[model samples]
Target chain A: MNKKNNLLQCPNPQTECKECPIRKMALFRDVPEDDLGWMQEFRNSQYLLPAREILFRQGETAHTLYTLFDGWLIIFKILDNGKRQILRFLLPGDFFGFQVNSIGPTGGYLHSSLALMDSTLCAFPTTQLRLMMEKQPQLAIRLAEMEMHDMNLCQHHLIGTGRKNAQERIAFLLLELFHRVRLQKQNDYDESSNSIIFPLTQEDIGDAVGLTSAHVNRTLREMEKKGWTQCQGKYLTIRNEEALSKTGQFDPRIIISKPLI
Target chain B: MNKKNNLLQCPNPQTECKECPIRKMALFRDVPEDDLGWMQEFRNSQYLLPAREILFRQGETAHTLYTLFDGWLIIFKILDNGKRQILRFLLPGDFFGFQVNSIGPTGGYLHSSLALMDSTLCAFPTTQLRLMMEKQPQLAIRLAEMEMHDMNLCQHHLIGTGRKNAQERIAFLLLELFHRVRLQKQNDYDESSNSIIFPLTQEDIGDAVGLTSAHVNRTLREMEKKGWTQCQGKYLTIRNEEALSKTGQFDPRIIISKPLI
Candidate 1:
C-alpha cells in the first residue's frame, strides 16, 4: 500500500518531502506503482528561500535536482561587467539541476536562481536521479522535452537582444512569464495574460533584453501610458494580452509541449 | 534497402533539380527501413533553391522542413525597425522549420532565410510531415531534439546580445562555426594550409552577430591584425583553431557533441 503520505525515510537532509500539494506537476505522475513508492523514499525538503535569496551560485557543483513545490525562481547569467540576464522563470512542479550522463558531462552552471517569491521544493541527489532516468526512459525523455521548452524561451530572448527595442522586449517578457506561471496554477492570467507576479527587477529585465536599467524603466512607463499594461513595482497586470504579445513579438505556438514526466 | 538519396522527387516548378550534385542529402541516415521508404515518398527537391534563395518567406506557413545537404544557410529573424538579426548558422544535414500547431501562424513573412553559400536540401511537406509525426513518435521526438539544439544556439545568441562584448561575441561565433563545420567536413581553412575559406560576406556575418557591416568589417580587420584570423573578402582562414578559440572565450567542452541527428 503506497499512500501519498507514508512516512518518508531517507538519509539526505532534504528527504522530508512526501505529500506535496502542487497538483498540476507532471513529473513522476506516470511512474508505476512500485517505482512511485521507490521515488517517495528518495525525496526530501532542503530549504525554502524567499525572493532574491540565492539557492545556488555560479560555479557551484550541482548536488541535487529541485522540484519546486510552490513559489517562483529565476535562472539567469551574469556578465563580467556585472550585468545579468534572467534566463527563465521556474515555477511549481518544474524540475532543475537534473543531468543525464548518457549525454555527456553536465557543464552549464546555475548562474542565477533566487526565489522570485517564497518557494518550496523537493530535492533529490543527482546520482540517484540518474538511476531513475536510466530505469525510466520516459523520465529521461520528459526532461529532454522540458529542456526543449526552455530553449524556445531563450530563442525569443535572442530576438529581444538582437533586434526588439527595450519597450517591446519588456512587454514580451511579462507576457511570457504570465502565461508560463498561469499553467502551474491559476494565479492572475489565462493562457495568455500580461498580469503576473514576476520577481525580476527592471535592471534584470534590461540586462536580459540588452538594455540599460533606465531604458527598462522608461519602457515600462511608456507601456503603462499606452494602456498595454499596468505596472506596480514588481506586480504587473496586463490590460491587453494580445497587444502585449505583439510588443514582445513572441510566438505563442512555440510552447511545444510533451507529456510531462 | 534504405538510402539517403531519395530526397530528389520532383514537386515545384523550380524542378531544375534533377541533375543537382547534392541531390537530397543523406537525411534518412540510419533510419529504420520501414520509415525510410515512407519518408522517400514525401521528399521533394523542386521546392528547394540555391543559396540566398527564399525557402519560405517570413510569416509564410512553415510548410516544409529544410535539411541542409551541400552548403550553409543562415536562420534569422527581421525586427519591426527593418533590422535583420541573424539568429544562427545552419549547416548541411541540419533540420529547421518545425512549428508547434498552437504557436502563432508563422507563415510567408515573419522571417526570411537565405543561403549564405550555394546549398542544396530536401523539403518535406508540412501536412504529410505532421501526419507522419503523429504516427512516428520517434520522428516527432527527433524533431523536438533538433529544436532543442537550435534553441541552445539561440541562447548563445542571446548571450552575444546581452552579455558578451563585440570581440568576445565574434570570437565565440567563429570558434562555434569552425567547430560545427569542421565536424562534418573540412572547410577552406583545412584544405589549404590550415586556412578556413569562410565564404560569408561581412554584411551577412553582421546580421548574424548583430553588428553593422562596417563594424563587422572593422572587427575582421582587427582580428587579422591580431593574427586571430585571416579574412580576405568572404574567405576566412582561421590562423589557429585552438588559439582562436581562446580568443573567443570558449570551453571546447561546451561545443562538444556526438553528432546528433
Candidate 2:
C-alpha cells in the first residue's frame, strides 16, 4: 500500500578499516589496526533509514548493534501515558543499539531509536562481536570505556532534565549537542567552522528537554532574540558562546575526552 | 588543626575470591574466580565514611573507583543555582567512583558523592585494575557490561524525572529503590522480606524526585494514608506493590537480570 521506501537495505562492501571515519573519534581513536580490521569484518552491512523511520522498537528483539555512520537519530522511551523522553541523540561516530542487545528479551529494547533524518547505520552482529572480543580482549576494554563515557554523559544530562528550568534546559541541550557535533567533526581535525546543521525538530527538542513543543519554540525564539545564537534554516551558530555557556553552565571539557582503558 | 577524623581508612586484607558479598549480583555474577581474586588483591583498602560526609567532590581529581561494601551513598550533581539532582542511590555492593578515574584531571569529577548514612567502601586503584584487566580480557568485557547496565538504568530514571508528574515521580523512585534493594538482598538467595532500610533523608528524596523536601514529606504522608506503603522509622515496606506499580508504571523485569558479556 505504501509506495515510498521507508527503509532500505544498503549493500556495503568491506572498506579498509584504517580509513573508517569514526576511527578518529574517542570511541575508536585508540583501537589497534588489527582489531579495527576485525571490526570491519564483523560488520554485517549498512542500512539506510528514511526520516521518521523506527530503527528499533521498544518491545522487539534487538540482536544487532549500530554505529551512526551518518545523519541523526534519537533514542527515546514512551511512558504509559504516551509522554516521551529523549534519552540521547546520536551523531556521526556515536554508537547505539548496544543497550538493546545488552539487555535481552526481558525488556526487549530498553528504548526505541528513531531516525530524525535520513541516516546510515553500520550494523554489527552481537554474537560475532562477542566472539571477536573473546579473541582480542583490548576490544572489550575499549568498548567498556566507551560505555563508561556514555554513562557519564547521560548522568550529566539528567541534571538539566531533573533540575534545570525550561530556558536553561534548552540552552544546555544546544550547547551540549554543538560540542558533541564539533568533536565528531574533528575527525578531519577541522576547527574553522563554528556552525552545525541542526537536525532536530521542535517536537524532538520538546521530548529531549521535557517541555511542550510550544514551550520549545518560545524558548528558542527568545534565545535567538537575545543574540546568543543564530538559527537560519538548518544551520545553528553560537554567536555568543560565552554567554550561552554561562546561561547553560555547560563546559564541554567536563565530558571526558580521554578513553578510560 | 581540625582533627575530626573526616576519613577513617579501615584495614582490609584480601578476602577469599569465592566469598565476595556482591559476587551473586548481575554485575559480577559471571566473573571467574581468578578475576575475582585479582580484584581482591587490587583493592587498596576500605574506608568508613560517616553520615553526611562527602565521598568525593566535583572538580576533584579521581584516581579510584569504589564498591559499596555496606550502608548507603548518593551520587549527585549540584546546579549553579544550588539545586541538586540525585544521579543514583548506591546500595551495598553497588559500584560508585567509576567516573573519577574515567575522566581524570581534564575536568575532574562531573558530580559529587555523599554518604547518606555511615558507609564502608572497598576502594580499588584504577591503574591497578586497568593493569589486571589487560591481562584478563574477560574482566574488561564484564566491567563494560556493568557500565552498560548502569547507563540503561539512568536512562530509565530520566523518564520519571523529565516527564512524570510529582506523584508518579515519588512512586517510581520508591518502587525502583525497593527493587534495587530486593535484588541486592538476593545475594543470599533468600526470599524472605519485602521491607528495606531506607537511609535517604527527605532532602535526598526530594533531590531524586525533583521536588521540595516539604513536597516529599506531604507525598509520603499521603502515600501512607492511602495504605499503599508503610514507613516505620527507616524501614519501608510495600503494602500494595501491585497498586503501587500500576501507579508508577514500575516494572522490575525490565531491568536486565543477566549480564551482557
Candidate 3:
C-alpha cells in the first residue's frame, strides 16, 4: 500500500488458484484440487511491481508472505556501512517474505526486495499462515521444501563471496541465473538458444557477488575475451558452457531439479 | 556408519524423550506431551562425535537428520580451490544435516559437519520426515519456523562476508556466538560470569568470517588491547558488551528470542 514503492494492486485481476499457470511449481503444488478454494480465499491480492521498483523495504513490518507469480526479484540487505548484499534471486513460483524476526517485538522484514523487472506477486496474510497450514498440512511440507531450496542457494552465495575470486563469482552468478531462467520455462528463454534476458546491472551483479562494479566489468570482459561467455544489451549468452562451468565450479545438476512444491 | 567419521553409536542409552533437558528448544518443542512417545519411537538412535571429528562428509548420501543434544559443531563447505567456508555454528538443541541435493541423482550432503568438541546427537531417518510431519502437523509448522530461523542466520552471514570489513565481521561472529551461548543457558555460561567455554581456533574464525588466521589473530589482539574482549585458554569473555555490540552493529534482541519450537 506504499504508493512510492510503485506497487499496483490487483493488476489484471486475481488469477484463480486452481487455474494458476505455474501451480505445479508454486506453493500449493501439493494441495489437493478440492482444497484450493480455501487458498483462493486466503490470498490477499495480487500486485504488479514495476521494473527496478521496491517491493518491500528492510525493517518494514512484514504483514504478508508472497509467491512470485511472474518476473524476477532480488532480496537484499543494506548494511550499516551502506553497502548492499543481494541475498537471493527469486524466480516465478518462488515463495518469500518469511524472512522476519517472528519472535521479536518489531517483527520486521530482515531484508528488502526489489523487482528486477516488471513482476507480479500473489500475497497471503501472514497471520493466517498457521491456520492455513493446519487445514492443509501439505502446504507446510511444501514450505519447508521451498525453504530448503532457498537455503541451499544462500549457502552457495556465501561460498562465492567468502572464497571464490571475482571471475569465478561472476561466472557462477551468470550461469546460475541462466540455468534458473531456462529451467523455469520462462518466456525469455528459447529452447534452441543459450541466451536469456538478463536484467541485472553491473552494480547489481557486484552487490550480489561482493565485488566492485569496476571489478565486475573487468572480470566480465576477461570472461568474454576468453570466448566463454558474453553479456551485451541485457542479454547473456553462454558461448562455451563447459569452460564457463569449469571456471565457476558450477554443477547444473545441483540447480536443475523438480519443483519441491 | 562411516568408521573414519568417528561416530559413536548409542551414547548413554538414549535419554528419555519425555525428560529431554533441551526439549523446549528442540524439534519437538511444540509437540504435546502425549505425542512425545511417538517421537521417541521415531528417533533412530543417538550418536557421539568426538572432539574435532567429522560427523558427516560432503557428497555422502544423506540418510539421517540430526539434533545436537550437547557441545559445539560447525557446518562447512570446502571449495574446489580447497578454501573452506564455515556456514553455521551449531549449539546444543540446534537441528542440522538437511543441507543436501535432495532431487539430484546423488542425493548427497551439500556440506560437511564437524564436532568442535565431544557432542551428542539424536538422529531421525530423512525418508520418514514427511511421514512424521503428516502424523504430527505441529511438527511441520515447527520445521518451517526452524528453517526460517536458520535462513535468517544464513542471510546474516552472507551479509557479513559480502559487505562487512574484517573487524566488523569478526565482531559480529563473536557477539553472535556469545549471545547464543549465554541465552541458551548452557552449563558453560555461568549466570554470574561473562565468559563461556569457547572452542573455535583462529583458523576456524578465519574460515567463518572470510579472513585469514593471521588477520583474525590481529583483530582479536586489538580487541583485547582495547579491553573489549578476551579469549584465553578455552574461554571467551566479553569485557565491554556495549562497545563490542556497537562495533559489530549487533542487536542482541535479533538473536535472543524464544525458541520457535
Candidate 4:
C-alpha cells in the first residue's frame, strides 16, 4: 500500500489511488489539481521529527510552509531572557510559518515550532508556493482567510491570558481543541458522547493556556475536586460539560462556527 | 451651478460638474453608468438635514444607506448603560448602513450619524441597492474589503482595549486620527496647519478610547508635556510621530500595507 519508504500511508483506507488519500485535511478539498500536484511534490518532502525537534528557529529565514497532515505543532516565541512562551498550537489540518510573506522578520523571531509527535507534513518551498499561489489565487485567498482564522484564534486565546483566570482558560481551551480534533476524528470515533480523542500533555496544555506547569496541575486538581472535569494523564472526562463551558464563559460558536460577517 | 435642491455643492470653487464637483472621492470613477444613474436618482430623491441633526439612533434599524456628499458625520454607538462610544467620524465620500443584501439589521445598530455641518447624502432603497450590486459584483467585492478593513480597525481597537494600558492606547489613537485627518485635508487646505478640523468633543475621544472624560484630559496633558502630540479643540499636532507609535507597539506596516498572501 505504501509507495514511499519514509512516510506512512495517508490514513485513508479502502480507497483507490484515483480516489487518492487527503479528502479531509481542510484545504485539500479546496486546492485544485495542479496545485495539489505541487502539494504532493512538496509532500515527498523530508521526514518530520519528534517533539522538541525544531522546524525553523525564530530569526532564521522561513523557507517552508507546512501543510499539516498529522499530529500537533506548537508556535512559540522566546523572550529576551531566553524563556520560551508558547503562543499557539495547530491541529491536524492547519498550516504554519506564513509570516513568511512580509519583507523582513519584524517580530524578531518566530521562536520555534515543534511537532508534539512524529507528524507527517507536506513542506512547500516558499518561492514555488508564491508562484503556485499566483497561478491559483483561490488557494492564496484561502491561505489569507486561514491566516486570519489563526489570528482570530490567537485573539481568542488572549482572552485566557488577559481576562480569564487560569482555571477558566484551561477549560475553554480543552473545549475548543475538542471541537477541532472532533471534526477530524468524527468518522472514526463514536459520536454519542465524548468521542473526540486528542490527548494533550499537561505541560503543553499549560503553555497553550499561558499558565505555569505547576499552575496547570493545581488548576486541573481543583477542577477535578469540584467534579467539573476528570483528568487521567492526557485523557479528560467531561463530568459536566455545560458547567465546564460556563466556568470558561466559553462560547462554542467562536471556535466552531465561521464569523457571521 | 447647484443641480437639484437637497444636493449640497462641493465647497471647493474650481471643480467642473463632470469632475463630480470634488476630485477626492473614488467611489464613482470606475462604476458603470447605470449604477451612477441610480446613485444620482437616489441623491435627488433623498431628503436634506441641517447641521448637528441626529440621523438615527444606536440599535435603530437603518432602512437607508447614506452616501455622503458634503459635511461631516459622526458614527457612535450607545452602550447598554446608555454611554455613547464613537466608532468613527467621517468626512465626505463615506457611506453608512452596511445592510445592503443583509436582511433587516446587523449586530451593531445604526447610530445617529449627525451632520457636523449642513450635509447632503444619497439614499438608495435596499431592494434597488441589491439590484445595483448584482450588476456590479466588483463593487460588492470592494464593499466586502471595506467592511473587512473596518473590522480590522475594530479588531486593532479591541486589541488596544484588551492589551494596552490607557496612556499608550490614547497616544496611539491621537496619532492615528491626526494622520487620517491630514490625509483628508491635503485636498482642500491651502492655509492653516490647523486643517485637521472636525470639532469632535474631547468626550468623543474618551468614548473611542474607553476612557472617562477626565482620564482623556489627563492623558492629553501628559502627551502635551512629553511633546509626543498636541491637541487644541479638534486641532491635533503630531510632533514626534515615531515615538508615539512605539508607545503603542504599533506596527504601521500592518495598517498601511496589504498582505501579500
Best by TM-score: 3
Please state the error at residue B190 of candidate 4 in Å: 8.9
Q: Rate the local accuracy (lDDT) of all candidates.
A: 0.61, 0.75, 0.82, 0.57
Task: Give stretches of model 3 more than 4 Å off.
Answer: A1-5, A11-13, A101-105, A186-189, A257-261, B1-5, B11-13, B101-105, B186-189, B257-261
Best by DockQ: 2
Clashes by residue pair, model 3: none
Off by more than 4 A, model 4: A1-25, A32-35, A38-49, A53-60, A76-88, A99-118, A128-137, A140-170, A192-222, A230-232, A257-261, B1-166, B169-224, B231-236
**What digit string (tens of lDDT, one per residue) describes model 1 on residues A1-261?**
111221123335543223444533546654565566677777654456656667766665566677777788777666666667666667877777533211223543436467767777677766575566556645545554566556556666777776666777787888777666666555533655445676777777776678888888888888888888887776778797788887677656554354321
True contacts kept of 3: 0.60
Q: Which of the CAPRI classes, incorrect, acceptable, medium or high, describes model 4?
A: incorrect
lDDT for predicted candidate 1 compared with the true structure: 0.61
The full ranking of all candidates by lDDT, starting with the best, is: 3, 2, 1, 4
lDDT per residue (tens digit) for residues A1-261 in model 3: 543547789746578999998887778999999989977888888999989999888767778788999999998887778899898898998887764422233577667889999999998887877788888988888888777777777888888899989988988899999998888885534688998889999999999999999999999899999998999778999999998888788888767543332
| Window of ten residues with lowest summed lDDT in model 4 chain A | A100-109
lDDT of 1 at A157: 72
| TM-score of each candidate structure, all chains considered together | 0.76, 0.92, 0.94, 0.61
Q: DockQ for model 3?
A: 0.57
Interface RMSD of each: 5.3, 2.1, 2.9, 7.2
Candidate 3 is graded, for docking, as medium
Candidate 1 is scored at a TM of 0.76
What TM-score results for chain B when candidate 2 is compared with the true chain B? 0.88
